[model samples]
Each structure stands twice: as structure tokens, then as C-alpha cells.
Target: MPVLETPPLVHETVVSDRREPFSDIVIIGLYAPKIAREARPGQFVMAVTPSGERVATALGIYEAAGDRISLMLVVVGPRTRELALLERGDRLVLAGPLGNGFQLQALGKNVALIAGGVGLASLLLPAQRLLADGARVHLYYGARTAGALVDAELFEAAGAGVSLATDDGSRGHHGYVTELLAREGRTHETIAACGPSPMLRAVGTLARTLGVRAQVSLEETFACGVGACWGCVVPLERSSAQAPAFPPVAPGETRDYVHARICKEGPVFWSDELRW
Candidate 1:
């Protein structure tokens, strides 16, 4: 894949906001022309709540069009709740198009994109990009219930083949979406996923069983959207594209793992390369 240029990071203002019927989720759009133009699929941003009472919250970049960048998030705390209450004219600060996003060019033409719950936030751009490239994209999405499957139609409308799964059987499949993927037994050139850790673990195992490559985005509470905080670190079996090149290990020092910053090094990593 070609190298992606990191856009100049800055704070942009909120230009649009809408509440989903799910009651706890809202979509916020920002007027960040620079970030919108440079951001690739799987990139994210850190936005301060409308109240600015809490630290900036990390959210996936859902859509980027013209000067607008939209984010879909479930309001689960004080920070997101404050963000959810914002209207079209609300002012908010944003920092990003951060982290290494999906390696779309290398993924080939047959791809499967998996999402669970709010994990859907990170997949839309990738699916859209893949479709634009004339790739066959299949979106396997799951939620706790039918209501939680927020934007299946959006993907379908964007030219992706959509498959659904809900834990309660309120949607397509009765169990985990990974099982749905497994049952289909379709071969994909690549599998990209973002969800809870358990869901990712399952997808990783499935990819291995199918002998297909997979990239997964790891979600964590990011204190700082940048790597300086080192709070959202995850262990990797080998150095990654964004991993730190630091002091050489001493003769006796263990080098089996390097702690990579999820906020900077990735929110996305190869499923096979991950140690966790």
C-alpha cells in the first residue's frame, strides 16, 4: 500500500449533529476540511465534549465529505453524553486524523469487513473505498439487538453486500457474527474487523482457520489521542510501522514484545501480528 500522509492536526468546529433512535447514540459532524481530505479509512479523531468538562474523547471518523467529518458514537459517559447533546451550530475542538488506518490497497478485490456494536463506526469508509475500487465488499455486522444495528442500509446503499447478526436473533443470524462468517464459508482475500476484544479474538481465530489475512482495530479508553500518554498500549509480537525505535536491548533483555500505542501506532493492526 502507498504511504498515507498524516494531515496537519488541529481543532475543528462541529457543524452538524444528529441523534439516532437507539437513544444512547448520536452522530456528530465536524467542519474539518483538512482532516477530511487527508483521513483514510480506519482513522479516528479526538473531540472535546461540548461542555469541555471532560478530556477529549476518541471516536472513529465515520464519514468525510467536502469540509465535513462525521462521527458515530454511543453516549456511555459524561464526555459522550455532553457530545450527544450538541446541535448543528455547537462548537467543538477536534484533533486528528490519527493512527495508521486500514491497508486498503493491499487487501485485494474480495474482502470481508466485520463490525460489532459500536465497532461499526470504523468500517464505513473502508467499505466505501473498497466499493469505489471495484472490490466486492461484504459487511458482516452484529449487535445486541436489531435496534443496535444502526446503519446496515448505509452500507447496502453504498454497494456492499450486507449480512446481519444479532445476539438475540432479532436480526439475521442468531449468535455471533463471526459464526455467521464461518458458516458462509466464503473465501475472502482479506478480513478487516473492529469490535470488543472478545469479538476481535474470535475473528482472529476465524481468519487463521480460513488461512486469510485480517486487520483488526483495537478499542481502548484513550486519555490522550496522541502517543505521548502511553496509556493505551498493546503488546505486539514484532515492531509495527508506527512502533517506536528505541534504545537497543541489552544482551539479557527480553525482546519478544514491544508495547505499541494504540492511539498512535494503531487503532488497527494485523490480526496475525498481535500478541494479545
Candidate 2:
């Protein structure tokens, strides 16, 4: 994983493009050269609403290339609904490339990238980086339906072998994507996954069964994207390098783990290191 060398700064960006790949799912492109240059795969940005009435929304950086970066969002609530209405040429303020990204070099030569729903947003850049390094990349992607499996072709075009699964049996596999991954057996050296908590937990369990280590990007609501608030906390083994350092435990306390801010220490963590 690359170290965060600079603090996040507010960037005044303009919406260069907007696409509705599927109903309620929007991908908004922005002209943010500095954010595009500094952002790493799996990191995110805090998008300030143009109205400035609601708290900023945290979204994964979907695509970052040259002078543009895009954000993928699902319109689920008031905050996201407001952002989804943005039009091309609109001004959107962003504070990011925030949080740590995946440790690409440590994942070895062959890797399995798993995603569920919009979790695909965080894995594309990792796939591109891995493929560029001459590594074999396979994507196991899942969604609720065939139409919801947006942008599998993007990964295929990027040289990743794509295997898709849908809940309704409208696509590749009838069951969960993890089932497809398990049936294929363990060909990869390591795994990196992002998705719903249930799916990520399944990936962690599967990784253990396959005798491989897995890195998971935990999905949580980050009230403060910079990690000042302890709102997005997960139990992590204290020995894990990502664990935050604090004063020693009190004399009566014997806990072996610490509360790690998902926005700071992670968004990505080793599956084995997680106590939650």
C-alpha cells in the first residue's frame, strides 16, 4: 500500500461527464487532475454537496486517469439523490484522494479480485496495476440481477478474465460469486475483495479454506472521511501493522485487539487480521 504523503485538500472540480449505466446508478466524471494524479486504487473522496446543506458524502474513486477521475454512486438516500442529479459542467467540491489503498506488490503474481454490486468501483485500478505488472488477474463479480452487473466489460477490456454471478440466475452463475470462486478452486496466490459485509465475510472464510491470505476492503459509513470520529471502527488484532497505536491497556483490561478506524487504517485490511 502507498503511504498518504499529503493531507487531503479541497479541490474545485467540474463535472465533465455523467452516465447512468443502470437505473439509480450514476457515474459522474470530474476534471480533477490533482486528485486523479494522487489517488490510488481503493481510496475514496468526500464529495461536498453543491447545496452545502448536508454532510459531505464519501464515495470510492471509480476511475482515475490523466486529468479526470470519476465517482460511482447508488442513489439510495437524500444525500446521494442530491449528488446523482449533478449535470455535466456542474461544479462539485471534493476532498480526497483519501484513505490507504490495496497493497498491490504483496498480493503476488496471480490474484483473484472479487466484487459485489458497486464494490466493483474499488477493484478496477488494482486490476489495471496487476495486469500491467504481468500478473494474471481474474474478476469474480456479483450483483442482484444481470442488468445490475454494470461494467464487467470494462474489466474484460482491461485484460482481466471476468466471471460474473447474479442472484436471479440471469447471468453467469445462479448462486453467489464466491461459490463460483470456490468451484473454480484455488489458482491464485492471494485474493483482494470488496463488497457487502456478508460477501466480504464469505470471502474471508473462503480464503481461509483455500489456504490463502485475503485482503478485504470493509464497507462502512464514514461520517468523517478523515477518521477523526470513531464512528467507523472495526475490531483488529493489535499486532496487525494497520492497528492504531494508543496508550497501553489499563491494568484490569486484557483485550488483545484495538478499534481501528476503517477510514484511516483501512478501508482495506487483511482478512486474517480482523477480529470482527
Best by lDDT: 2
User: What TM-score, over all chains together, does every model reach?
Assistant: 0.92, 0.95
**TM-score of candidate 2 versus the correct structure, residues matched by position:** 0.95
lDDT of 2 at 232: 93
Candidate 2 wrongly placed segments (more than 4 Å): 1-8, 251-254
Encode model 2's per-residue lDDT on 132-152: one tens digit a residue: 999999999999999889999
Q: What CA RMSD would you report for each candidate?
A: 3.4, 2.7
Relative to the true structure, candidate 1 reaches a TM of: 0.92
